[model samples]
Target: MSNLLWLVPVLPFAGFLILALAGKHVSRVWVAIIGAGSVSLSAIIVLMIGIGFLLHPPATGNYSQTLWTWMQVAGFNPKITLFLDALSLVFVFVITFIGALIHIYSVSFMTGDKDYSRFFACMNLFVFSMLLLVLADNLLLLYLGWEGVGLCSYLLIGFWYESEVNGYAARKAFIITRIGDTAMAIGLFVIFYQFGTLAIPDILAKAPVLWQQGASIATITALLLLAGGVGKSAQLPLQTWLPDAMAGPSPVSALIHAATMVTAGVYLIARMHVIFQLSPIAQMIIAVIGAATLFIAGFSALTQYDIKRVLAYSTISQIGYMFLALGVGAWTAAIFHFMIHAFFKALLFLAAGAVIEALHHEHNMFKMGGLKNKLPVIFWTFLIGSASLAALPLISAGFYSKDQILWYAWASEGGNPWLWFIALLGAFITAVYTTRMMIVVFWGEAKTEIGHHPGKLMTVPLIILAFFSLFAGFIELPHNFGHFRLFSDLLHHVLPETVLKAGMDAELQFQLLALLSTFGGIYLAYVFYYKQPQRIEKLRQSGFVMNLYLFWFSGWGFDKLYNVLFVRPVVFIANINKNDVVDKLYQGVTFVTIRLYRSLSFTQSGSLRWYVMGLVIGAIIILSIQIML
Candidate 1:
């Protein structure tokens, strides 16, 4: 089973190569087969490997397959190896499994696209890169995969190159993520310098021996890595890129948001858990960033009129929850939420795609009312996804996973009441925005005629994801409710169990508080957006309230702040330096060269006499120089 580990990532790479080279000559059916089939095959292999590992656990609690040496220089030998453990296993499963579903959904969603093959090619590459990122045995290989996804994102986001807006979004995603990537690269450099190797296991084993818990190097490295994760995951300061990323096709949005790019940061922080543990300061920063980000993004989600952008903001907020869990040392809980998030977020995006398609590409929720019966499959699935997103009590998988995070936020040894409060507040805002989205999109008066119903290719994926949205949490129930720990148990070998503060046993109270926040937010949204729409209008009439709404709608002015701080200065510099000193030097060289050329041209004069005279003069000058020497 370990020997077959190489096939997991290879399959998708092969699919990408085929789609890139021969897809244009193939039919759509074959394109779909090659595109979705590759990831599906990887999913099957992952399932078999997972079962085998469960039945016959490795002594070292991990399986490493070395395909070849990636590089060897100065005692730095990193192999092209695949590392599979409970952690990578979970991520690989999500990437390949949910990735396959999104690809299938894309086959139908992108039906009339002129660049259908190109879309699949990029999608296949995206999956392959993400798989590599999770499975790589060394940081260098992981970085390769990291930048691979970034590049693929740019390609897919700008797939509709005809739209300048889409192009801008793609560039924004690429450039913004690069900031964190740079920090991560520097962190890798520090790690290699300290440990003399890039192998993850070697680094993890050596970090503790080389540096104490509060060592400066350890803290710096951890914070650097966190910066990288922040940028890739679209956490604060870098989060503005994600909402605009919705300019891509729906499945692209689903794959990037739910299964691939945004989750990369979570995986990075989890994979480097040892470093974070060594730096309490860095860990606290992670917590604070997560708490602030979730609150800010949740508020922003409430103001979005575009359905995808709302979900986009929700993704940011949800990832913030994952960060919060990680910050509070709830490692398993963070991953648990990640798995559940993938299930439902993907469902919501796919269902939204169906609704958008049914309404002829309408994106504004206000313009898309009364879709309930017209698109019954989509309405139900979207409702299920929204319920999970809102963390509606026992029925939704989100409730269990989110409940665990909330519990650990205050109960863990590192946890505090303030982090818990912010996270809880975030939960309320999440439910409010989710409820608002549901009501505004599906429960109002009919505003647009249905364009067409979605085909089975699109709807089936939504149904499958919707199923997980409701039941995946059962694998990790709360202590007060069945105390199921299957998910955490599987991860115990890879990640440490979170420690609870001494004498803290208020899990039940925390759960109830989370439940109330969910229900309260839902009821409030229902009343304001559904039952009494006029209330929103009256609130809008208030000057300060409208200003606040506008602020949140503009992503809390992060973009504007960035424009003033970063964009304006850069543009100003470029405008001022249109013909800078360096250009003047080159221009001067050109001017001198042109003058010399004209002077030499006068000697030619397009005549035999002029040519003879020039040759004689050149010979005389050369002879005189030789004489002088």
Candidate 2:
């Protein structure tokens, strides 16, 4: 099983290579099969291995396979290795499983796309990179996967090359993420400098020893790691790129935003939980940032007109909840939430994509109404997804995971009452916006013609994901209700058990709180959007609120803020250096030399006699100087 782990990533990479190298000549059906089949095969491999691990658990609760010695120096060596433990197993399952479904859905979603081959190629490459990221044994290998995924993201986001706006969005996503990648690289260097190793396990082993020296260094390193996570996860100041990322095809959005790329940050933090455990300050910082970002993104999702943008903001906000879970020392719960979120979020995005495709690329929610009847499969699947995302009590997967996070936030040792309060508020807002989006898009009167119905290929994945979204949470119900701890118990072997533990009564409080927030938000959404749908117009009528709404709709003006703060300044500096510095200095030097040569041309006089006289004089002077020397 260990040796076979490489095959999981290898199959997708091979598919990418084949499609890229010979796609133009290949039939579209073969291309679709190759693209989706590779991932499906990998998912099967992952499932078999996961089942193997579950049945015959490793004594150490970890497994590793070393392919080769990646690098070696006197005292340092990093191997090309893959680690399959509980945490990485979860990631592998999500990447290949959700990734495969998205690939399948893309077949129909992108049927007539000019760059269908190119799109699948990029998707395959992304799956390979994401798998490599999770399965990597060392930080360097992980970074390689990291950059690989980033490259694929840029390519896929700009897959429709004819669209200038898509190109711009791709560039923006790449550049913004590179900023955090740079910081993450620096943090990796810091890790190597202090520990003399780049292997994750080795660094983790040494993290405590380094932390024993001082809290300051631990906090700094942790913060730097958090910066990288923030950029990748689309958290807070670095989140602007995610909303704009909707320029890509819907499956790409589902793949990147919901299932794979953006989740890289959460995976990174979770993978490095050993180092994070040493820094309470860093953990607190994570909690605060997560709480703040959840609300920020939740509010932003409320005002989005574009259907994908609403989902995009919802992804960011949901990730914020995951980070909040990690911040409050609920590692297993965070991973649990991430898995459940992937299923439903991908389902919603893909369903929205089908609607967009059916409406001839109409993405505005106002243009869509009464789609429930026109696209029944999409309507039902999307409802399940939205209900899960809105965390509608015991039936929704999100409810279980989110409740655990909130429980830990309030009950954990370092958990703050204030942070928990903000998180609950965000949850309420999430339910409201999600319900608002669903009602406005699917329930109202049909405002536009449905150009076509989504084919079976697209709807099948939606049904599967919707099923998971509705029931995946049962794997991690709180211990209070029959003391079920299957998920936590499985994770304990891989993750260091945090000291903070929720009692039965505390768990019950969390369930009640989650239920209230979920129901309250849903009711509020109903009253506002269903009962008094006209009230939405009234809210839009107020200039101040409308402006605020517009700001949120535009991702809280973060795109403009980033341009002003980073992009514009960089462009300004480049222009100044190009025009004022390099051009003037280089051209001035060349001009002066040319002028000096021209001035000396007078000595030639363009006459044979004068040239001979000058030569003779110059020779005499040179001879005299040589003689003196």
Candidate 3:
């Protein structure tokens, strides 16, 4: 069973190659089977492997398979190896499992499209890349997976290539993520330089002994790695691209924004936590970045009109909580939240897809009202996802996972009142926007007629994910409940222990505070959006309120700021030198050649006498030049 770990990533790659080669020739039904079947098969094998590992733990507590010696030099060698441990196991299962579900959903969601085969091909390839990322044994292999997913994103996000905006969105996602990828690549170089190895275990083992806590090298490495995570996960500064990434198919949104790529950063940080733990300054900055991004993204979610864009910002905000958990040394909590988040967020995106299809592709929540009956399945599934996202008390998975982070934010050894206050405020904002989106989309009067209802293929994935969203948290309830931390216990072998342990008194206090903030935000949302809708509308039109509204709607002008700061300057320079300065030498040669050709053309006046005279003159000039030489 352990030997089969190599097959997990290979299956998806095989599917990708098959689809890429045969998609245009294959029937659409066959395309769906080859696409969805490939991933589904991988899921089954991963389940078998996971069950086997759990039942018969390996002596080393991990399994590694070296497929080949990838490269070797005098002192440098990197191999094509796949590693399976508690950490990679969690990510692999989520990716293959949730990813398989999303691929299934996409088949029906994309029905009647001309590019169905292309869409599924891109999706299978995306899963293949992510599997490589988690299973990679070395930093070099990890980087390959990192860039592979980025390439797949560019391909899938622009799948509808006829649309110029979709192309723009795809490029934006690729370029922004590349900034972090570049940083991560440099961090890998730093690791090899300092530790003389690219293997994760080797680097982690050497980091603590080679560099003291808060050493400059440690800080630099930690920050560089964080840059990669921040960009991939859609954290602050690199986050603008995600909202626009809604330009892709809804299933693409679910896969990238939910189960896979966005979470890569959190996984990267978690995987390399030892280096981060060596630098308190780097760790503190992680907490601060998470705090700021959660607030910024939460407020942005409030102003979104597009249904997918709202979820996009929400995705960013949710990942911020994971970063906060990582920063606070709640390693188990961060990963636990990531799992539960995958369940709910994927559910939310898929359900949103069903609603959009039902309404003939309408996107504005303002325009979509009272879908409770029209889209009963979608509404209910989305409600489950929403409640989890809002961190509603007890019943949903979001409550347990989010509550863990909230408690750790205030109770961990790294805790400060300020970080807690900001996180709590962000939670409140999360609730407000989530409730607002639900009310606007599902609770009001019906604003439009329903079109095609979702087929079972679409609703089936939603039902499965909804089940996870509703109950997955029970596996990891907060510690105050007396050891319902099955989720954390399972991950304990891989993660480090946290210094923060709450006494009964402190746990009870934080729990109460979190509950108030949770319900308080919900209560306020009802008062503002549901109960007194006109008052909220009036506030939106108010002078200063409108300014803030526009700001949030424009993503706080980050795109515009970047345009002025980066994009425009580059564009301006290019325009001034529209014909590149480097090309001028060629251009000058081209000018002389054109002049000589024109002069020679005039001499060839369709007469043998002119041709003969020109040849004689050219011969005379060649002889004169040779004599001079």
Candidate 4:
């Protein structure tokens, strides 16, 4: 069963190839099966292997399968290998299983589209790439998967290529992430140069022995990797692409932006935890970046009227929490939150998709109202997701995971007072924006009629995801509550043990603080958006608040900043070089050659004698040059 791990990623790629080649010729019904069925089969295989892992675990708690020799040279060998352990298993199950669910939802979401086959093709390929990323045994293979997801993102985000705006958004995502990918590629080269191996386990084992704590080399490598993660996960500065990515289909938003692809960065740092642990500086930077991103994105989420854009900012903020956990040495807490985030965020996006489709692509939350009665399924399911996202007390999975990260941010060895405050504030912002989104989109007066209801295919996935969003955290309950840390304990072999600097009493205190923050934010949102809607209108009319709103609404102007600092300069240089100065020398030579030929044209004035004389002169000139040499 373990040896068949290769099938997990292979199934999705096979699905992609089939759909990509013949999907257009076939009916939409078959396209749906080929797209969704492929991922469903992959999920089944992963479940079987996951069961095997539980029943008969490997000696090292990891199993590696080398499919074939991929490439080999002197002192270099990288294989087409797949690894299965608690860590990769978690990621694979999430990618295939949750991914399968999203794919299923997309079938109904994209039923009538002309580009349905193309959309599914990109979607299937994305799952394949993500599976490869998690299952990879070596850095090279992982990078292939990493870049593969990036390409798939561009294709899917711009799936409706007829739209010029979508094309720009897709290009923006590609170019921004490519910056970090370049850095990661360099890091890969450095790792190969320093350690003489690209295998993940080998690198982990060798890095500590070869490099000291706080080593510059290790710090550099860690930072480079963090850059890649930051870009992929939609962290600070690099996050501008995600909201714009909402230009794509809602299923694309749900699958790539919410669930699988956005979490790729978290997986990278966790997979290479040794490097981060060795460089305290690198870890500190990770925490700080996470802290800053959450705040920026949190505030940004507050001002968004676009339903999908609000969730996009919320996704960025949530990933910041994951980053903060990684920085504070709560590695398992980070991944635990990542898993939970996937469930709820995907649910929210899908629900939002249904709402948008029902409204004929209306995205503004302010323009949408009183959907609770009209679209009861979407309203209820979206509420569950939003409640989980807001960390609404002990009932939601988010409270369990987020509370751990906040407590750890304050209580871990690497934690500081400031980190905790920032996270707490971000949590407040998360709750506020989530409540605001739900109130505006679901509650209040009706702004439009619902033309259609989401079919069973869409609603079923939401119900399944909503169940997970509410209860998945039970798998990793805090020690203060009881001994239900099954999620972390399962991955104990892969992750280092986490300790709270402040013990159980402090744990309860942080939990209280988290609870308070969640309620405070929710209360504020309810008061502002729900109970007294006119107050929101009045506040919007104020010059100061409106200015503040506009600032945050523009994603803190990062896009404009990048455009001025990077994009505009590049475009300017490209324009200036459109007719390159370097070409002048060649142009001058052509001009002179033309003139010389014209001057010599008189020599062709009609005669065998003139031709013979010209031939004789050419031969003499060649003879003279040879004699001189």
lDDT by residue for model 2 over 492-583, one digit each (tens)?
Answer: 86675456565688778778988899899999999998899888789889999889988887777778887798879999998888778768
The candidate scoring highest on lDDT is 1
Q: How many steric clashes does model 2 contain?
A: 0
lDDT of 1: 0.92
After superposing candidate 2 on the true structure, give the runs of residues whose Cα lies further than 4 Å from its correct spot: 73-75, 499-502, 588-629
Ranking by lDDT: 1, 4, 3, 2
Answer with 2 or 3, whichever has the higher lDDT: 3
Q: Let me know the TM-score candidate 2 reaches against the reference structure.
A: 0.93
lDDT tens digits by residue: candidate 3, 1-629: 99988889888888888888989999989989989998998999999999998889899989999999999997788999999999999999999999999989988888789988888888988999999999999999988999989998899888888999999999999999999999998998989989999999898888889999889999999999999999999998899889988888899999997767898999999999999999998888899889889999999999988999999999999899999989988899899999999999999999988888888799998889989988888989999999999998889999998887888888887778888898999889988899889999998888878987898999999999999999998988666777767667678878875867567789778878878888888888899888988898789789999999999989899999999999999889989786887789889999999999999788768999878888999999999999999
Ranking by TM-score: 3, 1, 4, 2
List the lowest-lDDT window of 10 residues for candidate 3. Answer: 496-505
lDDT of 4 by residue, 1-629 (tens): 98788888888899899988998898988998989999999999989999988888888888899999998899699998998889989888888888889999998998889888988899999999998898899999999999999999999888888999999999989998998899999999999999999999999999999999999999999999999999899997788899999999998998886556799999999999999999999999999999999999999999988999999999999999999999989999998998999999999999999999999889988888999989888888999999999999989999999998998899999899999999999999999999999888888888888888899999999999999999998999997999978888788779885666667988898899889999999999999888888898898899999999999999888888988999899999998887686877788899999999999898779989989988999999999999999
Please, what is the TM-score per model? Answer: 0.96, 0.93, 0.97, 0.94
- Pairs of colliding residues, candidate 3: none
Which segments of candidate 1 are over 4 A away from where they belong?
Answer: 502-505, 603-629
In Å, residue 121's CA in model 1 sits off its true spot by: 0.7
Better of 2 and 3 by TM-score: 3
Q: What is the C-alpha RMSD of each candidate to the true structure, in Å?
A: 2.2, 3.5, 2.1, 3.5
Off by over 4 Å in 3: 579-581, 611-629
List pairs with backbone clashes in candidate 4.
none
